[model samples]
Structure formats: C-alpha cells, structure tokens
Target: MSIQDQEHTAEPSSSPADSAGTRRALRADLLRVGKIGGARSATSSAAVIEGHALIDRRTGVWVPLAERRRQAAAGSPADQARWDRLIEAVTRPTQPTEVSYEKLVVRVGSARDLLRTLADTLPPFVPVAEVAQRIEQRVESGTYPPGAVLAPGRIAADLGLPLQSVHLALSDLAGKGVIEQQANCRARVPGANPFNDRPRQLAQLLRALAAGGAFPPGTALPGRRELCRILVTGDKPFAAALRLLFQEGLLERDVRQRLTVRRGSVKRTDPPKLPAPAGHVKSLRDDEIPEAARRTRAWWNARLSPAPAALDQVIDQLGATAHQLVDRAQPGSVPPSTAQQQLSALVARTAITAAAVHHPHFELRLWHAACLATAVCDLLALLDDLDASRPSRRTAMPPLL
Candidate 1:
C-alpha cells in the first residue's frame, strides 16, 4: 500500500451535538462484547441514545455494530477477511494448534483451557463461608454499616481465623469490588448496587448520613477505630464490605477532606483491575487456518502489539500493593523496620543469596518488585527535595531512633 493509503483516519468526534449524525452513519454497525447499560457520564447522554439507536436489539451474543460497518466498507476481499478474523479472535475462542519440529512438539491452548487446568492444578481452595456469614450478620444488625473502617488483627482475633486468611478474604472482596479501601485503613459502603450486597451496606450509610448529617458529604467518614466501634467488628470485613460500595461510585472522597455522594443516579465508572493468574502468558499462533486467519494475524500483530513489562517491576508493584494492604489492616501503624531489616539480612546470607542469584524466575519477581519500589522511593525523594513546599508536605516525620 502507498504511504497515503496507509495514513491514519480520524474517528468522528463523539460529541453530544453530533450524536444524531454519527448514529445515522454507524447505527447498523453495532457489535456487542459485554453488558452495556443506559446513558453514562463517560459517554454523553446523546451518544448513549445514538448507540442504542444503532444496535439496541437484544441478541444471545454481542457484535460491535460500528466495526462491522467499517468491515462492510473495506472495499476488497482481503481487507474484509482481515477485519472478520480480527473481530473473531477478539470475540470468539480460537482453536488449539499443534507445533512439531523433528522430535520436539508442543500444543498451544486457549485461555479457557488454561484457567481450567490451573484450577485443577491448585490444591483445594478453603471456603470462607463462615466468615462471610459472620460479616453478613453484622451488616444486618445495626453494628456495622457502610463507611466503617476495619482492623485485620481485631477481626482475626474475633473470628478465630489467622490474620493472613482474613487479609486474603479482604483482598478477594476488594478485587470483587465489594468494598472501598482508603489509605489509612478506613472503608465506606456506597450501596451503589444491591446485586453484590454492596448496595445494602451503602444504602444503610447513606440513610444514616442523610438523617444525622454526620460529617457532611465528602468528609473522610471516620478513622478505622471509630468506625470499628460502631460496626462492632474489626477492620477487615468492614473494609471489604465498603469496597463494593466504592466501586459503584456512590461516594467519593474530595480534595478538601469531604466524602461526597453523587446526588444523581450515576453508575460507577471505575474499571476493576483483576490480578492476572500465575503462569498466564499471551498465546502465540502458528501459521495455518484460512485466508481470513492470515490477514487477521497481520493486522492484530500491528495494532495489538505486546510490550511486556520487566518481571522485576511487576514484583515491586505487587509488593507495594501488599504493603498498602497491610498498612490498612493495621491503621495508624507502620511495618516493622526490623522485619525489612531481617529480610535484608536473609538476602545477605550466602545460601539464600546464591539461590536467588541463580534462580531466574525468583530473581525476576524479586528484582522487578524492587525496581518498582525504587521508582516510588525516587518520587518520595523528590518530594523531600522540594524546599519551597510546606515542611509537612516536603518531609514525613523522622523515624524515632
């Protein structure tokens, strides 16, 4: 193709006034991938209206209406076939492939198969039903509502579960968007939806706030200890429960230390970042399949380029997430300096140091996490460097000797 032919084409502006025009153009092109609902803030009211106008009809499976329209206009068989495969690869599962060379052979599998295999490979997952039930009871009673802080230790002590298990449950709930966690280990329920029990907790808090006018909307609701007393539980369950509400976007903390509720019926916009499963890697395909497949591969390789992050950095980011989580479990507390010191001491030991230095995966996960932490440390250092900023902002209090 000539350079001119390959030049980029700009998408029509998704502006409010132009909705009718675009709807008329792209209406017949709708393709569904996932559940999409009524008008959202992210998509202006007009765009939502136009979107529904194009492909509002319900179907068992989703097809992107706009992309299909573009494919119909590809003007050539090769172009059309390419777009078709691209759409399929994204929407449907590709068949497994076998590779052979001399005595070596391997089979590449689908994401579904891999997840299933991993599930089977894992040791039986212990159920947390009892703990979940206990938390449910507290929520039903007047003890804990939305916007309560959690203390992992206290909860662990009360529930008779290891502190680590309680922490794990909280992590799982947070990932599920069943709660909202703040920096200082505080939590609140936004009650944006009733489906996941998040809405109930949130509704309870909203009703209380409405009646009591306690700490005006947008105020940091309360410290974890204070919330724990009201909720009649430790922090973990409270934080986990509040996470769901926060995900729904009913309540938000403002810059000036206020907790504000979105007065309107706005749906949540935050995307959840589910942790990638261990040993999961994007699949690479072999040369085969139909004509559509070849073109599909070429186009996807160009556009959906894979740029893997360094392994070391990923571990550090994971560590940072862990540290933040731990801090929340024990509010107004810091990780023991001696713990980190002991970890360093272990690294210095000859046997451990040698094993870590030699093991590639181990080294990758460790160093990657360290590299990320270093970047964070660098930013903190810069904050310290800024002389004009307020002393409070410029420096954290010095550690006690």
Candidate 2:
C-alpha cells in the first residue's frame, strides 16, 4: 500500500494521553519497517522519516507524519508545495555511479625519500666502541657468565643499537680474546681454564662421595691438603671443586675454617626430567606475530585515527610471510642461509611498508619484525647445532658386533 494510504487510515478516538502512546507506536512501526529492508533501503526510509517529521516547539516531541500532513493541508499553499516536494524526493530512485579503480603507484624514489625523512627523525647512532665497552662491562660484572650463549641479536636489542654494530663489537671482543666466536654460531664468554676439566671432575667425585654417605651431615671431613691427595688433584682444582660444593650448600666452613658436610644436606632424590624440545621457530612466530599485531592495533586506536585499508594489507602480508617462514623452518626443509635471506627481505619490506604508509609507530613494527627474524635465526642456529652433533653421536656409538 502507498504511504499516503497508510497515513490516512482512521484510528479510534482516545484521550490526550492516548495521543502520545499512538505517536510512539507509529514511530516504532516505521523503524521496524525500515529494519525489515536492507541497509541501503533502511537508510533511505530513515531519510524519508527525518524529512517528513517535524519537532513540536512547545512540547519538544516529534509531530507525527499524519499530524504534520494535516497541518500542511490546512495551511497556506507554500506548505502544501513543500510537503509535495518532500514526498517526490523520497519516492525518487537512487542512481548507481560508475566504478573507477585507480592503480596505486609507489615510486622507489619516494620510498627512499621517506626512508631519509625517517632517518632524520631517529636518534643519533650509538658508537660501536661504546656498545663494546657496555658489553665488556656486563661480561666483567658476570652478568654474562661462562658457557652462556651471547646472541648478537639479543645484545643489539638490549643496547638499542643496530645489529651490525653489535656484530662488529662482538667480533672485536672475540679477536681480543675477551669472548669466543665461531662461524655460524653466537659469541660466548670464554670459560676459565678451558683446558682443565679437573675441577668439574673433582666436583662430581666429591658429590658422589657425599651422596654415598662417605661424608655424613655435621661431620668435619678432610683438610685441603688431605682432599688434594685423596682426590689425586692439585690444590687449585680442589679449591675450585670445594667452592662448587660450597655453592651447592653441600659443604660449609666450621669455626677453624675446616670443610664439613652441611647438616641436612644429603637428599638422594631423582633428577627432574627435562622437557622434550619443540620447533622454536614455529612456536616463536606463532606467539610474537599475533601479539605484535594486537599491540599495533591498540597503539593505532589509542593514538591515531582508525587504520586505513593499506595498513590492514601490510598486516596480512606480514602474517603470510611469517607463515611461510614457519613452514620453511621445518627440519631439513630449508637451509639456514635461505631462511636468513628470506627473513632479511621480510625486515626490509616491513620497514619500506611502514615508511610508505607514514606510520608513526614504524619503529615499533620494525623492531618486532627484527625480533622475529632474530628468533628464527636463533632457531636455525639450534637446528644447525643438532645436525652437527648427529654425526658425532653416530661415530661415538659402539659398533654392533
């Protein structure tokens, strides 16, 4: 039925209170009808309602369409003409516009320009010597102990310096014998007396003796010279071994500074089982990518306007790249060199994308990408270690005769 016919339908006469109730019911019906149509139709219906409805100046309530039409009919010619025009406008069909797609051309020079601008905005480059000095201080202070893997990536992150700078500093330290570095492996602090396994061996022997009840709790054991002779070790190694025992709370010094087995120290408990190894690359990528994306979304929402379509595209692309990297990182699937190359490419692309979009949080995004790349690289290194050990393990196996 036409809207005019629906409006003209007669209602039963009621009290003044009923008039307000009737108006609310009519408004609800109009809204329900609008919702029954789809979004565009609903929008058009809402526009028609807004165009027809008039506010009561005194009552501050919306005048119903029927009442407005009645007033227009009784009023001058201009009011009738205005109402007629509104009805015609509401009934008119909307036209579809021609869809034109434009190609987004990103010039290489423009990206370079953006990079230059970003570089200008960044903090001054930290000196390689300064980075090396900081790491040296950390090493001397025992923050990085012997046998600890000194990952360049981790050091770079901690120092907030470039990875290359950290690498150079590590190389210098390694050259000077401050740390040890080998090809395709992270740098490591040199252990005290690398040639001597005597201290560790003596430590194990003493621990076994204590566990076997040779030295019971609260009993004063041998002197330093006696231990050296009995254990067939020198004074230096015996002292070091005793130090290890002291650290383990198995041995303590008495009033005369004699070595005694500490009371309540002997507990013959089974060693805890180690957990099975997992795919580090897959686990790290899974954990970090989504977290980075969430942080990016929150950061953008809090500080900037809603993200544009291009930002979403960049995020999707990053996710796809991460997935691809995880797949390639499977055991013996892709070599470390290839994985490293791909990761480097991903980092560069992420930086370029951030620059292209003029993202204020570009540094944050780049850091996350670099961190993921570093984790993947570390995983590759671990895989390399496992592979290297396999042949040695095979050779060491007793021949089945």
Among residues 3 or more apart in sequence or in different chains, the pairs in candidate 2 whose N, CA or C atoms overlap within 3 Å are: none
lDDT of 1 by residue, 321-386 (tens): 323322222222223554333222221221111122222332122322232232233223322333
Cα distance off (Å), candidate 2, residue 203: 11
What's the TM-score of each model vs. the native?
Answer: 0.18, 0.23
lDDT of 1: 0.34
User: lDDT of each structure?
Assistant: 0.34, 0.45
Candidate 1 versus truth, CA RMSD in Å, comes to: 26.0
lDDT of 2 at 213: 41
Output the number of the lDDT-best candidate. 2
lDDT of 2: 0.45
